[model samples]
Target: MDLKPYANYLRAGSAMIAGLAIGLLATVLSLNAGYGFNSLRAGPWTSWPHIGGADIDPYARAVISRSGEAPLGRDQGLAFIARTDSDGAPLDGACDYRIVDPLPAARYWTMTLASPDGRLVANPTERYGYSSVDILRKEGGAFDIDIAREARPGNWLSPGQAQRFVVMLRLYDTPLDIDSTPDPNSFPKIVKLGCA
Candidate 1:
């Protein structure tokens, strides 16, 4: 009996398996850059509903473990991330952004701009984030931050040269909990300005 037919079938099966492996790898990489399926939305930002908790799903736990960064404990704080502007456009370094309006209830907070990989950007401005103590607030707990490569007065952040970026918001000592998520409207808004 000839073995040609069996060998051909084996080759086809191997190719299919390889394709599936590559697809899975790509998906995991994408998820590593963004939040997993347990994402919670707050206006333009996204967060892990199970942050700093041990009960996170397998995918979320994998991402957190692989990153090797310690998330604050449940009673410590919560972190939110935004990959797009208010219009649902990807945050681009070529464009400008305005983070404005009321923020969530917290004793203190900070806003940071980072790369898709969550690494701090390198720019001449040397500004990485804006803290509640440093920010200029308007009446009624409102504030505006200008995000661009160029110079701006008041609160400002630089995205460096990266084309795609993400913004991070950290709330310290907030009253919110896992079961009680306040309305997203209470969070600040990130609006994209004209691109150069």
Candidate 2:
């Protein structure tokens, strides 16, 4: 009996099925690994969506006020809160941010980008923060900050490959004209330039 044709067909079928199974397994494993890594990395800092008006943390409350100012002991310094999404959360990786100093004659200001893990975003230039003094501004003293995956022309800070990031604004020694109250008008407004 001639069984060569039957054997060849069986072998081909088995190989095809095996290849498909391997590919499926690989995809599932990759997804699982990615989720596990993110969970482990987030640890306790993973902020869930704020529900209702109760059970709010002090830090979250400060962020909600949009007043970047945080109490640094007895002294009252300049600080402004960065704006977030409609859900009262920080913008994800794709969104670009521009932080402008509210104080017109403010001498110094800085915007530092940090990863979700609370570490400074690593850049090739070894610079993790953007400062008004270091950035190039127009003659009238206007500068813009670009936060995205790729580098922009001026005042651009790479947010790394992470899906989440946070921007910390520091208005160093702001002018005495500004009020001490924590209000949205007291801080700089972070305008969304566009998507990366």
Q: Write the per-residue lDDT of candidate 1 for residues 34-128, one digit (tens) a residue.
A: 54666667777877757577666766667777787777766888898888888888889999999986888889999998887789988888889
- TM-score, per-candidate, Cα-based: 0.85, 0.51
- Candidate 1 Cα outliers beyond 4 Å, as residue runs: 4-33
Full-model lDDT for every candidate: 0.82, 0.53
lDDT of 2 at 97: 65
Kindly list the per-residue Cα lDDT of model 2 for residues 1-196, writing each as its tens digit: 9999899999999999999999988755653331121110111112112211345444444444443323321122343333363235566777776655443345676777776434676756566787776887767876666776776787878777657776656555545333232334434456667775
How far is 50's C-alpha from truth in model 2 (Å)?
23
Cα shift from native, residue 156, model 2 (Å)? 0.9
Error of 2 at 134 (Å): 0.8
For every candidate in turn, the CA RMSD to the true structure comes to 2.7, 14.4
> Which run of 10 residues does model 2 get worst, by summed lDDT?
36-45
